[model samples]
Target chain A: MTRAFNFSAGPAALPAEVLQQAAEEMLDWHGAGMGVMEMSHRGREFMSILAQAQADLRELLAVPDNYRILFMQGGALAENAIIPMNLLGQRPDERRTADYVVTGAWSVKSQKEARRYCDVNIAASTEADKFTRLPAQAEWRLSKDPAYVHVCTNETIHGVEYFWTPDLAAAGLPDVPLVADVSSHILSRPLDVSRFGVIYGGAQKNIGPSGLTLVIVRDDLLDRSLPVCPTAFHWKTVAENDSMYNTPPTYAIYIAGLVFQWLKRRGGLAAMEAQNKAKAELLYGYLDNSGFYRTAVAKDCRSRMNVPFFLHDETLNDVFLAGARERGLLQLKGHKSVGGMRASIYNAMPLEGVTALVDYLREFERSHG
Target chain B: MTRAFNFSAGPAALPAEVLQQAAEEMLDWHGAGMGVMEMSHRGREFMSILAQAQADLRELLAVPDNYRILFMQGGALAENAIIPMNLLGQRPDERRTADYVVTGAWSVKSQKEARRYCDVNIAASTEADKFTRLPAQAEWRLSKDPAYVHVCTNETIHGVEYFWTPDLAAAGLPDVPLVADVSSHILSRPLDVSRFGVIYGGAQKNIGPSGLTLVIVRDDLLDRSLPVCPTAFHWKTVAENDSMYNTPPTYAIYIAGLVFQWLKRRGGLAAMEAQNKAKAELLYGYLDNSGFYRTAVAKDCRSRMNVPFFLHDETLNDVFLAGARERGLLQLKGHKSVGGMRASIYNAMPLEGVTALVDYLREFERSHG
Candidate 1:
């Protein structure tokens, strides 16, 4: 494999070993006499593969016995609408208010979709601060007897992350459950499952591929679907059937199962968290010391998975990208809404890739500054 | 590649040539220096690929000028919910209602999901007869001033099909438009575009892969999405953005585009329909002539793609499946609910595959009858 780093936000770089294994198995998976793509989803071979994947993922995350893991389709964006549809039935129809803490673009989108299904109150927002940082949980306006409180734990665009799941019970929100979008940083760290009601993410970033969504939802929240909620997307039906209510995204699920196996082989989430932490620190240390560049997000809230930073001199933007590309660093361009550079070092990214990027950054700054 | 016949029901066989081409281009697509999966969705390379696929599909189906083609995710199951969320806004909130004609499994599913968004009236049904035949269009009790009328043109499980679209206007009913689930039989034949307001299919069966969904919708139905519809799935937004509101199943789209190109090279839909007809005739003729086997669906309403049949004695099911598997005819097992054999002869299955199946059927009947 070439020594290139791909840093696109989602649909980002995959593990080199995983891609190699996928390529090797593309034509025939383990002498099954058919490619994984060609296997019948209901056949014994695929069913075994699906089962092992769910089991491995459960072990890796240390998921609580109370929660059910579901393999779903339509990605995380669809889940924004689906979550509210399934959970808003918790309260009496007239008292179905859901609270949201908007930290960035993804949370804003979540709140907008939630408004369609229930009464929504924005408990906290960072939009007024240009989404440079997540607001402290103490400065909030939470709704009483709300069905659920929603938060995007990792904001993909603005690069802010919640390092810890806030304790809702201690904060006078004991009755209200918390839901989080951990799309960008799901596998980068170990999570506390008992603290949250639902944890969901699109699989494209750290899991395996696009089109598959990973939802870790409590069984208690499974049955309260709105009368108008689509049955296929209703958590109750999906959880009951083990996510086989409809034909799941079979191939994507197969690939994701492979990813779970790979994660387990690499010593599970704890090992991954250590690697991710070291990589983030190395890259952030260089950026902190470099007078030529600066990160916009507050240091405490900055995402370890996504590092968005701007060069002090805007004129060096094209030159910076060109130099980076020449050195085999790819897809480092930041989102268009926030024009700068971004390096999304997800779970698949090796620490060596981060060191290489840091070395390049230091050399470039020395020459330009 | 091995010369095996694949009869998988959905996640079914693809053309051998298509798989070969994909393998060859796995690392780099059209000398673009990146795999199709790795390319940005908004990049020029993938954009051209997407546009060509859409244009060729439009041309092959003789799609009306007013219809917009959308490439979406979440399969036919998601479309069950998406269709209503996008279309139910056509009527006043208090007056919105949709009419459904439930011929089989897929129609029942669509109607069930549509109830989440609109008041549904069952226009026609074949449940009393165990879904063995299509309901006659004349007997449909269609609602006046309904938002839309929906039907599953082909039922994959029941193996029943509507050979023709119902002409609602000519039947003296209000001119409510038609929406059809053409998933199982989409490219198997030519369709009259003007007869339906919306036509959609999941790509896994006859198109290409599992993740991509195709929706051909009339232009007039573009703008009236309900307030609750998620922007990502709202047809109007996807249609306006040309299906790029979210990161699509890019590699799936590329493979589907390749399938469309292959279909065109083999002389378009007319030629395809003839080949499909021959294949279906060969299999059905053998089943009909052999007293040992029987197809339950009415002869006139049998699906050309999915042919579900049963052994007369019911004791030979295991022996039949074993013999078929030994001959490299894979995934011939029927749906669990049907407890028989289903041979899905989609567009990719060659005439020779059907001949082999027929030959095997004849030999088995001679030995066992």
Candidate 2:
């Protein structure tokens, strides 16, 4: 079967090896007599799968003993409200406000959703620049005693990313925690888990599939949830139950486990980072050289995972997309908010796929120019 | 590959045909060149899949046009809080109370979760009876001005099913909506959708897989969500966005769509109900006749989907489960809360599987009795 190089953002591509393994084990998982989806969450067979997945993830990210990784649901969107519900109570006597660095569309949504639970202070915002760049940490305004600082390390829609982590201690908010929404670019490289109090992302982009949300939080932060937080979404409750407080997305987690295995075989995140860098450079280099296409985001902060670009001749946009589709380069259409083409080369996207995309880009430019 | 007869409680058995089709389409779906899990939630292919699944479900249950079916996540346990968060505000100015008929473990949990949102009145409870029978409608003492009335129509852990729907209109609470968590027995029989304002279930049992929660709420009930409800969990927002407010569990929905097709091919719920009854009768009939094995739940209210039983000598529980596994009967271990054995013969469990289970039961009884 011919599989296309899918470039859709979030719910994007997964490793061929992972899908192949899943297909083979669909009916009988390790001779367990049933597929992973059919097994009871409490059963020994599924418990093993869950344990392996959690262990592999911890090893891959080098998550410290102080952290608890939660396999949650409702995606990153749901986590927007959940984050505030869990964190706002940390200093209830204080004004119950959190600092937000609004870099792009996702961070904007994040801050807005948090308003439902607590007061939000836009500590820094680059929206004035059309979300084309990340705000410099030096320019961020300090909140006297905010609950936590929130940021979207990677903006899938706006195609901007933070290459460096914010150091709250250096900024004089030593005790204040830093929360990041790393949905699009998680697992692309090694991360200092100690730097952030909480890191969360939707599994669809770089992990496995939609519906399964991964939340990695410092163990100490788990107890700060407000009374209004749903018991199922409570971080402490989920951690205490080992993510089976309710039946987790079993098949999604299993698929994610298969992906973790695939990543490990490929030499983990360091190797994946190298390959991702090469793929991003290959496409970006071609775009930089070609006069026919141009990316709007600032060069230094452009997302290595999601690259949104516009045709030099805006009128040729439809023709460019139609041609890209013909050559098996799919989902080249950009987000409606940003009227241009976007190619999200996530962790699962091989360099060969990016090469094909560059090849198609050159051909389309040569003909259309 | 020899397939076993799996009887898991919630993340239970699925139709073999659906699993086979899913395996075949793992890498590429309908020549789209990417699996369903890999497709964009907004893409034409996945949207068609989402539309068809919703349509098929609407047809299968004869859901009225006023009812909007929502594909959510976090399972029934999460819905426990989400329900009150969305419904408690229906009559905000009033005493802010909701009535609950706690017949079993699930409904008791539901009431406890709701207490976090508003005052919860135990309208009727059979917890005193060990949840072996449904509390009669005549005995219900619902609140005069409740925001809503809640019930667990089928309790998976208790093995009790509500064969009859509770009529709030007949109970002098016409405007107060009746909400039911029909997680385990949702598709096992024909449901009168018009009777309930909200009907929700986790999909793992009879629909497709874990991680997907189905919510069928009448249109009038959507706008009653409290301001504190997470927007992602708001029924109104979800209905307006057609359950696409966030990236949904695409693969799970695709599998559910396949099951819906399988259900339609097998002559819908009516035919499924007949087969389920016959299968339940075969196993329950055997347990009733044999002194060696006895079911704890009342015959009239015993779940056709989940049949919980016990050996006269409780010490043989391990021996019974071991023998059942050796003979390809799986997941017969009952929940720890009510230990013994539970054979969950969901819609996917064929009569032959139940027959095999009965044959094993007879053999075990004769050899040990």
Candidate 3:
């Protein structure tokens, strides 16, 4: 049977080709007599895989020479706490204050976890707007001499996106660094790495799987961990050891590496950005035109990766889901916290999958509305 | 195609039955329309998978009601630092000392990493004896009021096993709890859960795969994490959330759950213990009898799973490995840290796989010894 278009907000759909390649290589990776999962993490085979993955990702994002990429574990949730522990000590006088722009649930979580290790300042919040929009940079009440400014560039839950990177330097916070959690929309577009101090995400979305996390931090931000920080999690230690200070989520890393290779073969992040934009546009265009579908987020702020739209008649949710299943579209149910349908069109999602989903949506609207 | 008998130290061989089932379920888990890797961790289908795995594991290990089973990420190496961070607050007023038994490389790593969190006391060490034996309990220089006495009960590299749990109460350390890193030999035999405060292991060796870790912790040890502990790594937070505090390594956990169910179907840990004994006996008996092969660990302390053997003539190491590979016995190469071959026959290794390896060993000896 052909695989369905899985739109889970993640542990979500991987590219069918990538999954097929993985299945084929499950037993032997390139005639090495061992699966990528079975190879030693330090072995030449895995090393080459790791190196290529880093290079490809860096190339795709145009990550600068001043930045170091670390493949870590425990997802972005873990990094929320890890980031503070590593950076809070950059100022020696006290636990430095870190500013957060709370756009949605993910940023809220990052802010809360950061409070355990640093003095967190909520510079701006979309909570009053129910996390449906990004706060304008002018509204942010950032701290003086903050360790870093944090933002969730794309809010997975609220389906909100920051179309452009926030400019801290232009906002008179030139000395402070900006950290972004781009978990859901990380690889869907090209990024200007020099504009941010740190960018991290869980691989469950566009990368590969749940066990791997990707962290890109500027080299200048290295080695400022508080004494209380666990050595395994210390950015300096992890960076120096080349993410091998601990046994990494080796298999997840290998799979993500394969995905990076896949992305490159498909003509890099620029091509992916175009494809993702097209898929999102096709789905949202249908939703916008239909009287039966209503999207919650402001049109300008709507996420290009995760588009959450509700049926005008909420009772039609069951019928909509059933129709979707019959058409081999899956995980279309939105987060229970927000009742609606969400289509996550990550880089892995082809235009055909979105087209199939859009066709089903229109047919369902014709019948139900 | 048949798989070779892989003897990798870790990211090691899995039960063939488990792999077969995993492959069969790779596309859809019990008709759920998603592979374990692709499912949202919070979905009901994956929840049932997670719950059954935890429950089955609890029953198999005879874990008491007071203990919490945490399925975590990052392997045992990360636990080295996480453990101390979580446990050192046990005695609030005193600067708690965590005693360590350094039998080999794993314990030495544990000790070094623990220093990052608390004062470490080397209660006992067999490194002076070249890690060929476990030090006697009487020989330990126990620190009074230690937070815990830590030991790597089975050293994978040294091929040393503690046949008996240390009687710390009788050794004048009654109040101190025991923590064991049972990564290599956790399920090979029955364990007294009442004796250990905490036990953790990376799943790749005897469990399922590389990304998942199994941590069993006693009730009394749950609440004392240092304030500086990363909330995600804190045992209490992880236990309270039932390992769903974050997106888990869903695929690895599902695979591990399958292995647990498979173990239950085969009469649980007791049957596994018996089979492991027979397999170890067959391999060790041949090694003891063959003058060409020699095992350095004391016979009484020999590991039932990992058997490291040296050839009398070291020059034929390459030839021995090449011959073994030719006969479909693969990864017989020894760790670079410890020269000579090591055969890791975990619970996944059947009697036949061991016999095949032994047969290859004999043939290679005849040709090159």
Candidate 4:
């Protein structure tokens, strides 16, 4: 009955209400005599669930009419290759190249994967600064007639985030479409759907669970898939079929729908963003004051969702994690590459969880400082 | 809760016991303080779940040590292209061709998708027979030096099941590996894993849910992926990473693992096969004896998992489904392409459910005939 404040990034925490509702409907969904997982993807009952989920997501994000939202699989990692395959085909006669703004680990992986499908150009990179901040849009080297400009708006591993949408026109790349991997911080705030050509993220972070990926692409971009793109992964085929070209992760979608409903009940993204900001401030504010812990990411571009911080005394890292777990504060261990502690406070994580984490951080520091 | 006998073709019924257990552990799995869906893929808790699921599946199927079981997404449709991409590069100097035995709708789609990556040869096809029967192995005309020979052992749409494995050696294609999409009937019976180089299926029918695809591939064949293969879909990388190269559909995998445990508790595949046989006999026996209903699939090849039948008077089709639903029998409507009724009695469908279905069939016939 005692749930921990789970902070593991991606496949992280989900709303308690969503899980409770799911548990109640596990055997029979809405008296349909079968659980959501057991129902046919094409059945009337599941169709309703699918429709509601899609509609809820659209309303929550205020998705433009010209955009198509696709519930896909293979996570954001698969989309690295899939994105280029879908975009590079738009201009077959032109040079097959795409621009990537590498902020951290995810964008690094994204650009490398796209290299297999097209010539990847790192137009902007914060890797030189150890991915501590987002690269300024003014400093980005524009590519002439590139297929698309890719960016990881939120880097889960490095705890860096883009506070503002990169305007291609401002960067002298007006014609180039901006594609963003917004996996970690998608629903943590309100987004201008019209600002990007395509926005995609795995559902495990701010959404529901892993396995279900949400891709929101402008309708015009749907027809630009390469011949080599798998039929199931092809945006046009999936969009045309209403994401039913393949049997989508039904239960995942249902859970995500439940999450969307929960979000709406909590006053949608604007309210959520406000709470997220408060939670991030509570933790970051404490970290900034404490000499025992130090957050490396720049203040302006620090991810409100994922906060990776290091112990001032590195030797106490193990002790810090062990004590946190004892207090039911879990998954605070940082990514192996980063070698520090990370707290991913996604949409599902309540302020209470953050307060508890901060309390534990202070307690650990009081003893170890 | 008045649970019905759900007969969805895929995304089909799951064991009630598994569903109940999942519900019980929804918010807190094994006192870990977070559900399986909330756990990090690399965390000890979820890793144990992944390991156990893989081990249980390996044990249930008696998969050989040389085989690596991969948990993937994108369903069977995506695997259609992934298969060719992963297999075609074994012989770069030779013609890129793969032989397919198209017996039904799934295999037809499978072969068509493979055409995107390599030359797909229809080695054997029962399309002339309306996929009512499996084409005999002796009749196969496989290509010379094909990367692999593929087959849909059980066609969910056509209700044609292969009672025996196809021996490549007997067909004079000894070295050519055999790949079978056993999606709809995978766990309904004992499988000889050694017979196929790769055995994959969407974990919807005879498994757990939609979204998770299981690929059991022999280790030697894992390294044959083409350069164009997405890293996430590359079987070699997937196998080496233990299917953790991407954030897998964790919750779906957890559910599938629970079903695997349920299967073992139900005395493994041998016991499941016996019950499945009995249930199939009850329904098929009724269909054969009744003049009002007819199953078109060849008697020897009729699937024990999916029984597709038609009303003698086509006008009464709607009435049949309505009555069946009223009697707590659901999803009896056949695929639109086939235009009839299909009762997909997977491993989860008990004999009592089939008996009730038969009772309804008798009542409907007496009332409408």
Query: CA lDDT, every prediction?
Result: 0.85, 0.93, 0.85, 0.92
* Segments in model 2 whose C-alpha atoms lie over 4 Å from true places: none
RMSD of each: 2.1, 0.9, 2.2, 1.0
List residue ranges in candidate 4 displaced over 4 A: none
Residue A326 lDDT, candidate 1, scale 0-100: 79
Predicted candidate 1, C-alpha RMSD:
2.1
DockQ of each: 0.45, 0.84, 0.53, 0.86
Tens-digit lDDT track of model 1 for A94-182: 98889899998889988988888888999999898989887787887887777888999998889999986777887787867799998
DockQ of 3: 0.53
Q: After superposition, how far is residue A99 of candidate 3 from its true place, in Å?
A: 1.7
Give the alpha carbon lDDT tens digit for every residue of B173-276 in model 4.
78889999999999899999999999999999988889999999988899888888999999989988989899999999999999999999999999999999
Q: What is the lDDT of residue B15 in candidate 1?
A: 82
- Extract clashing residue pairs from model 2: none
Q: iRMS of each prediction in angstroms?
A: 2.6, 1.0, 2.1, 1.0
Over B1-369, each residue of candidate 2 has an lDDT whose tens digit, in order, gives 378999999799899899999999999999998999999999999999999999999999999999999999989999999998888675654578999999888998999999889998999999888999988899999888888899998899999999899989998889888999999999788899999999999999999999999999999999888888999999999999999998899999999999999999999999999999999999999999999998888878999988999998999999999999999999999889999999999999999999999999999999999
Alpha carbon lDDT at A168, candidate 3: 89
- On DockQ, the stronger of 3 and 4 is 4
Off by over 4 Å in 3: A93-95, B172-175
